[model samples]
Structures are given as structure tokens and as C-alpha cells.
Target: MVPASTSDPVPAPSPRPQQEDRDRSSRRRQRSAVILSAACWVSVVAAVVVFLGSGKPAQVTDVAGAITAAGIVTGLVGTDLLLLMLVLAARIPWVDRTFGPDVTMNLHRRLGKPAVYLILGHGALLTVGYSLRDGLSLWHQTLSIYSGGDMLLALLGSCLLVLVVVTSLVAVRRALAYEAWHAIHLVSYAAILVALPHQFSAGRVLAETSPQGVYWICLHIFAFGSIAWFRVAAPLFATDAHQLRVARVETLGPDVFSIHLSGRDLSRLHVRGGQYAIWRFWSRGTWWHAHPISFSAVPTDTGIRVTVRASGAGTRRLAGLRPGTRVSFAGPYGVFTAATRTAPRLAIVAGGIGITPVRALLEDRDLGPGETTVILRATDRSHAFLWDEVRALVRAQGGTVIEMLGGRAAGAPSWMSAAAAHGQATIHSLLPDLHASDLFVCGPAAWTRLVVHDARAAGLPDGRIHVENFTG
Candidate 1:
């Protein structure tokens, strides 16, 4: 029942419905984005105001003094950027919904280097400035600063911060285990705590009685509170109430396995299809590696399943887990579900094991017959992990399915097979209603981008296309 045929004349659209519903949702997202961006920038501006207005802006009478004044400025701004970085990583649901987790993580990485550099420059410039004012050598000034209040702990914190950042760089991270990297990154919390004493005790602008000081203190509280509540307290509460556990594990295909989890009060979970959760398995060897997997089917009152391809070492450990292995989860996150649908028609493209979310969506969404089409891609027939399920659903809904096999053409900048490329098959070729349909593409990021490129080339509006890369 692999109804693998879509080579036919296209059907015409029936009378259209109003675009108000889609437009309204899109507008709300736009407004939310604007508000979040403006708030972040506003914090930066307020930090500058507090610094300049705290006292008569220090007049630099000499080069050494000028360097010192600049150092102060950098210190204020660097701390501001660091605070922003903390907020980005706090996993706040509102922030995640507004800008997306991927976009927020990208911003976190982008701000890291510059924030650290500014802090470094602040340290260097102040060392020179203070040394000149005191008629002491650089080494003597450094020793003197370390001897005075909280500087030693700050120095140690800075070293740990540097280590965290260096290990997080893309090249260095590839060599480290996810668990190891995460352990190292946790040191960032200690670094931030230790670095705080010197800022409050040493810096002139953040003196305890000052307005700037109050604002800065509030910023720290808000940042720490967001992380503690969302990443810690909320998960703890949810796990206690739900009592989630592994019910069974089934082999789905070659090297693929599905973990069926059962829990209580799942309706309170507020989950949707096509969304994923971060699953932490409480097994002897696998307790530390939290796996991100999407639902293969929409959850029931007490049951859910997450399908995984056991390629990585961490994933391979899943098979040995005994029934009733306790499970803790963080979310039913991601915006690639029905909420992203902007049209009445649906066209989905999924590759390899990327079919997980798409399969869930197919089952969850209310698509009329002939209102959807799907293109499933795999390296071969066996790799098409859920093709039968897809075939059954698409056929039941009167939607067409096209199964693409084999690798891309030699030296070709395409995501399709050699045969399809030769036949001039494009997104529009497989999906004749491409312009009117909401297109969902899930795969490796690079291959997903190529599909998006094809859609864009055919002049499809960006809003009509949705992309999901399984980044958890």
C-alpha cells in the first residue's frame, strides 16, 4: 500500500476562504518580535544612562585617564551584554515562543565573544590606568588589585569563564561528549556568581545606594529567576505530578527504535503533535544523556512514543533500558505543528528519520482528502522508516505520496536523486499546489535549506513555507 504516485495533472483550487485567520496570527507574532527586540535594546540604553548620569562623566586629562574612562564604559556595556546573554539562555517560554529557541541560541553564541572581549578589555585598560596613576609596574598593580577585596575570586571566575567559552567553540565542542560539555558549561553559573562581588564592591557606578545599582541588581535577579523557574522548578513540578515512565520499546526499522512512555494527567501536559520533548532516562548507563525526540503519534491520556535512530552512542544506550525506567521531560516544544499552517492545503517533505514529526502531524491535523501531498525521501527503501504509515495516512486522506530514493547527483547542488534532477523535478513538479499549500520540510539543516531554496525559487512566499531542524 505504498501509494507512491504524484505524476498527474494538477487540480484547480476551489472557492477560496478569507485570509484573516492566518494574517491575524502572523501579525501577532510580528508584534511580539518587535516588543522583545525593543525591550532588549532598552535595557542597554538604560545601562548607559545610569553610568553617565551617576556622576559628572569623568573628564580624561591624560591618555592614562582616558583609557581608564573608556575602561569604565566598557565595563558597564560588557555587563549589560552579559546580562542579555543570560536572558537568552534562560529558556523562558515567552522568549522561546517569540524568537524561537534556535534563534535565541544563535544570539547567545553571537553575544558571548563580544561580551567576554569587552570584559577582558575592561580588565586590561584598568590595569594600565591604575598602574600609571600609582607609579607602579603592571605586575605590581595586578598584585595590588588581587590583594584588595574580591579580585582574586573574580580572577578565578574569569579563568573558568574563559575555559567554558573556549570549550564551547564549534571546533572544540565536536571533540567533547554532550554530557561533558554540559558539565563544563554549568561552571558558567559559578563564574557569574563569583564575578558579581567585585562588580558591586569595586565598581563606582553600581554602589549599593545608587539607582544604577538597584537596576543592575534587579537584572541579575530576573535572569537567575527565569532559569531557576523554567529550567528547574517547572520541570520538577511537572515530573512529580505526571510520574512518567517507559512502558515499552519497539523496533521500528533497521537501527531505529521507539520508546513508548506512559504517564498520568497528560492532558495537563498541553502537548500537540509535531512537537518534541527532552527526555531524561533514569537508567544506569544512560541517566546523564538527555535525548530530544519528537512524538511519532499525538499523545493519549497516559501514553506517548518517541522514535529514535540509534546512530550516536547516547542513542544506542536506549535499547537496554528496562520497562518502568523513570522518565523526566522538559517540553512538548517547537512551533512546526498546526500552528504554522497558513493555508488550507498541505505539502510535506521529509527525509530519512526526519519523518517523526511529520507522521505525528499527519495523524493530528484535520486534512480533507485531496487537501495534502507528501514527498518522502530516503537513501533506500529500508531507510524509509515510516513509509507504510505515511502511505496509509496520505491515501486515507486522498493525498498523494512520492518516495524518492538514492543520493544526490554527482557534484550537484541539489537535495534530490540523480534521476529526479535529470528529469527536472522540482518542488513545484512534485507539489503542483505549491504556491497555495503550506509546505513543511524537515531534514538535516543543509538539505532542508535546499528544499527551501527550491520553494523560494518558484516564487513561493516565505510565510507559506515552514522548516524544522531537530535541534533540541
Candidate 2:
């Protein structure tokens, strides 16, 4: 009798707690948005009431004129703040290791452009209005005393707006580097802090005469304060107290290395396969700086393993590190997990060093069987990182590994035909019927774009193709 296969049947993927957390957070943001939007309309109505009630001509000195100006400026700024908060809450990391960085980053770009426009309007109107009211120069006018500390508060608000715009631009951001850009963006909290004083002190609607105005003001404070506490403070407090210490380090290839880190309560760490953590080596002496890296090894009884390929300054340092080094991690963040959808067949495609996340998925006992396929495309055979390990894992899982050696892999037409052939022995061949399958592709921006385009040309549905790019 044929020996019973020792390999366990592939387990069904489970729901990720992080996705649930994100859903909950999205609901809260929607509710907040509704309330804020209603309050904005209410403020508009109040401004109209103040304007119609006044019999005086619409001169700059008139109370109606001032009220109208203030209302427009406040509404613009408040709305922008609400939108930005909602975007930030969605938590799209440009180069997120999990969730195939491409999708998340595209959404971020779409939202960012509108936010910049709103911020510009808020700054321009307020500056001109103040300059006209006070007889001083534009800069000096913002400094002049107003009935309720509005001018001083406005000045501080302007400073924050300047910082946000400067750091958000791509050119300035690249020069500052990722670490520096993140640090500068943190000042957004300070901007919100300064704006609060101006809103409370100068807001005419918030005065005792308008009870509804006070309600709106209170709502803004509650929404902003809650976001700050949860997004910033909670993470700092909740991470493990005893940082991870590197137990072992091994260079697998020219640029690839496996780093094993162990710390207290390793089992309870609750990190998922295909997810990444932000690592900060203590030797760097900069706790604020951290780089996102994919977890390489399957979580074992001892510790966690992250595979790194030297790419930049921070990663180069990591590749050179010895064993027994201590490091701090901020997360097990990213939505790139097997739990997102269910399918009869799964295909994983990785280009260059993008194989890191795919490797983790291969190790998962939950994703094996004849239903899965792992495809890796590298520039050349010599540059094919993780070739041996990937091949072994694929065979063990009853899956196939497709390695396409670019540049010189025989004639183009023949090579393409061979790579697309179907059989048990020809692992590089593409599966013919791929309509109902799920495909996960991760790589540099250009490679991911090409793969996605080809997959679509091959009759793959848009929903079935998930592309993750690290560059964006």
C-alpha cells in the first residue's frame, strides 16, 4: 500500500484581527464625518442669520462682514482637518510590506492632492482677512491682538500649515529621507494643538448666545483628541517592554540574510505570516527611526525571523549586524495575509527581492496542496535570490515553482512557450484555466505593473489580482 502522506492537508485561512480593527476604525470615522459635516452646514446657516439680521451696509468694519469672513475660514480649515484625519486613520503606508504596498499607496496619492488644495484655501483667506482688518503688514497683522486671542492662534495655525505643506511634497520628502520625513510629519499634532485655542477663544457661535455652536466645537475636540490618543499614544504604550534580541544571523546569499530575534512571550506576540514589523536597532541610538521589513521565518517556539536584503542605508547596516543585537519593533502591521479571500487555487508571483513575503506564505502549512503555485521572476539566474529554498518548499507543498531567467533564457518565443507549458515536471508553466484563481504579486513598481498587465491580458479578473509594490 502507498504510505499515507505525512503532509497535513492545507488548513483554511482564518480572519485577521487587524482587518477587524481597521473595519471598526472605519466605522468610527464615518460617524465622525457625518457629525462634522452636519456641524459645518449649521455654522453656514448661523453665518447667514448674522448677515441677514444686520441692517448696516456690508463694509469691512461691520460685524456681519467679520462674522462671514470668520465663518468661511473656519469651515474650510475644519473640513480639511476632518478629511485629513479620516485619511490618516485609514493607515496606508507607502511602502508597506504587507497588503501589497501598491493599492494602499495609490489611494494615499488620490486623497493627498485634495487635502493640499483645502489647506491652501484655509491659509490664503485667513491671511488676507487679518491683514485688511489691522493696519499692520501681513506678518505683523497676524500678531495683533484680537477680542479673543484669535490673531495669535491664527499665527500659530499658519506656521503648522507651512510645515505640513513643505514636508508633504515629494522633492522635499526625498531629500529629508524616510526617517526625517516621518519625524517632521509628527508636528501635525502640534498644528492641531495650536488651532484648538483659536477655535475656542474667537468662535462667535461658541459664545453663550448659541448653544448649538458649543455642541459643534465640543464634537471637533472629541474627534481630534480620540484620533491622537489611539493612533499615537496607544502604540507607544502597548508594545512589548523587553525588546527583541537577535539570537542568530546567517547570510543566505550576496544580499540576503536571515535574522532571528527572541524576546519574552514569543508565542503571544501574535504576528501573522506575510505581515511586517518596523525595526529599530538599539545600536543606531535613534529610537524614532524604524524601517519596515517582512518576517521571513515561520514563527517557531523560540522567536521570530525577518529576512532582509540590503537596499538602503538602514538595511545595509542591518545586513552587517552580528548576532546578539537588541532591537525594537513597532508593529506586526500590514493587510497582506491569506485571509482576505477564499479561492480554489492560489498563485503567488514575486520579482527580485520581493520574494520575502511570498516565502513566508510558502512556509504556511495553511496554503499548500495541489491548489497553489509560486512564480518568481528574476533578471538572471545568478541574481535569483531564494531559488533553492523556494523550490524545496514548493515541492513539499505539492505546488510548483516557475523561475524565469531574464536577459538570456533562450529565444524569446521558445522561452515563453516553455515557461507557459503545463505538466508535473515543467513547474515554470502557467496554469491554463485561471479564471477563479487568486494571484498575489509583489515587486518593484515597474515589474509589478508589467505582471499585473499581463495577468489581466491572460483573462484574470481585477479582483483576483493583488499587486504589492515596495517602491511606493
TM-score of every model versus the real structure: 0.93, 0.72
lDDT (tens digit, per residue) of candidate 2 on 290-381: 77888875576457888877777667677656566768765666655664433456787787778877777667645435656666766666
Query: Tens-digit lDDT track for model 1 on 1-472?
Result: 2224854334644534434566677788889989998988899889888877777366668878877877887877877888788888887877877666778888888888887788788888889999988899999999998885678877787788788889989999989988899899888778878888888677744466688888888988898888889888988888999999999999877878889999998878877678788889999989888887889888888988899988678898998778999999888677778766777788999987789999999988766657778898887878888788888887877788898888788886888887788777877778878888889998888889999999999988987887788531
* Candidate 2 deviant stretches above 4 angstroms: 1-113, 123-150, 204-234, 241-243, 285-288, 408-431
Model 2 score (lDDT): 0.59
Clash pairs for candidate 1: none
Error of 2 at 125 (Å): 3.8
Total clashes, candidate 2? 3
